[model samples]
Target: MTLVLFNKPFGVLSQFTDRGSPTTRATLSDHIDLPGVYPAGRLDRDSEGLLLLTDDGRLQAQIADPRFKLAKTYLVQVEGVPDDAALARLRAGVTLNDGPTRPAEVERIADPALWPRDPPIRVRAHIPDCWLSLTIREGRNRQVRRMTAAVGHPTLRLVRWRIGDWTLADLPPGQHRIIG
Candidate 1:
């Protein structure tokens, strides 16, 4: 099996092509040139971090399918510091438009040692922001963003730090390494 670990940068689409877009946008083809490899899962265009690509279909299923219950960890920067009550709500799972999310392992964390994001996250002199480390086994559409917003701490930035045993490690943004 051929596995590629890519540190996807912000504003880059998860797919290899941006087929019907009115305007040009960054896509995986800009980073990956390998044939047959496809992203095992997805990260939003605005979110940054570890993205797994593989040529094997079964491996892709194992990584992306929620039925497998592989844990995905994220380092999230939210608009405001979350109190214990907010963190508790996140840990217990909060109801969203789609439905209630599965319980997540959530904790307050210091700002991670990370590469500076280009066009850095907006700053507000009055409203303080904080970071959180969150791990969830389910991947829903914009679930992390929704979860944080649901608890009154909208995410200012989101980074997928790990998926199962795979991690971004020291790989810089917009870079890829062959892992298998």
Candidate 2:
């Protein structure tokens, strides 16, 4: 079984191919050349970090299926410093338009030493921003972004640092390493 860990860069599609898109975007094919391996889960095009791909279908199912409840951790940079109440809401669970999200492990964290994003997040001279380490078991469509926005602190940047036991570590963006 071939298990590959890819550090997906911002603006790169989770899929291997880019077909019928309105604008040109980078796809997984640009980073991963290993044939037959498919992505186990998806990372949004606008988000960056660890994406696991494998040739084994059972392993892929284990990783992606919500029933397995693999914890996904994200390093989120938000527009403003979130107060205790806002953090409490995230910990308890927030109601989104789709539905109420499962309770998440959320905490304020120091800015992680990460690689610089290509375009960079928008900055305001007066407004204060902060970093948060959030872990959620379920992967919904832009769940992290929505959760932060719901609490009044819009996510400025999102990075998936770990999925289950797998982590990005020092892997630079757009690079893939075969672990097993």
Candidate 3:
């Protein structure tokens, strides 16, 4: 079984097949060429980084299943600088429209070391944005983006830096490497 780690760039879909829809955009075919491998987990088309792909079904499930409790860490840039109280709310579970999320390991951090996005995030001089290192074991749909928004700081950019024992490390955007 071959396992690969890829830095999923922003605006790339996680699937291999394109269904010929106008908004379906670009699929994994546009980047990766590994024939039998499938994505172990999903990152929304707008989000980026640290995606795992594997030919083994068991390995894919092991990484994607929440029961594994594999921590996924994201470098999130939000609309405003969050205070301690707001950060605490993030550390404690914040209530989203769907339900309450599990408490995250959250902390303020300096702007991440990253390659610039193709269509860079819009900047507002007066907004005073900030970056955070937020880690969670759950893989809810768009959870990171929703979490920051629930805390009154909408996320401007979200990049997954690590997933379980895997990390982006030295991989630049659109890069991939074989693991095992």
Candidate 4:
């Protein structure tokens, strides 16, 4: 079975099917040459970073299933500097509409060297910004964004950095590489 590590670019859908859109453009199918492989997990169409695809159902399940405790890390840029208390709240688990999420590993990180998004994030003159490295074991719908919003610092930009043992590393946006 073929296994791939893809650095999904912004504005690209996670699935091969476009669902009948007028602008039928890029997708995982456009970049990944491997056949019979599907995304192990999904990154939002607006977010960019490490995505795993595999033909092996067992491997895909191992990575995507919350029971495996695979960690997914994201570098999030928020509208304001998050205080220690807010960080603590993130680490202690915040209640979302779904329920309280498992406590995440949250810490401030240096701004990574990143390619500019196709449509850049809006910048406000007065509001300060900060970046955080957040690691969560569970895959929840828009969990990171919801967590930040719950803490009063709305996320302006979000980029996934790592999933399990894989990372963004040297892969640029719209790039992909096959790995064990």
Show model 4 residue runs off by greater than 4 Å.
none
Per-prediction TM-score to the true structure, in the order listed: 0.99, 0.98, 0.96, 0.96
| C-alpha-based local distance difference test score of model 4 | 0.90
lDDT per residue for candidate 4 within 134-169, as digits (tens), equals: 999998888899999999999988899899888889
- Cα RMSD (Å) per model? 0.6, 0.8, 1.1, 1.2
Judged by lDDT against the true structure, how good is candidate 1?
0.96
The TM-score leader among the candidates is 1
Rank the models by TM-score, top first. 1, 2, 3, 4
Model 3 error, position 95 (Å): 1.3
* Cα lDDT for residue 169, candidate 3: 96
Poorest lDDT segment (10 consecutive residues) of candidate 4: 25-34
Using lDDT as the measure, what is the rank order of every candidate, best first? 1, 2, 3, 4
Clashing pairs in 1: none
Which stretch of 10 consecutive residues in model 2 shows the poorest summed lDDT?
16-25
**What TM-score quantifies how close candidate 2 is to the native fold?**
0.98
- Candidate 2 Cα errors over 4 Å, as ranges: none
Taking the tens digit of each residue's C-alpha lDDT, what string does model 1 give over 15-97? 99999999999999999999989999999999999999999999999999999999999999999899999999999999999
Which lDDT tens digits does candidate 3 get at residues 103-139? 9999999877789998999999888999999999888
Better of 1 and 4 by lDDT: 1
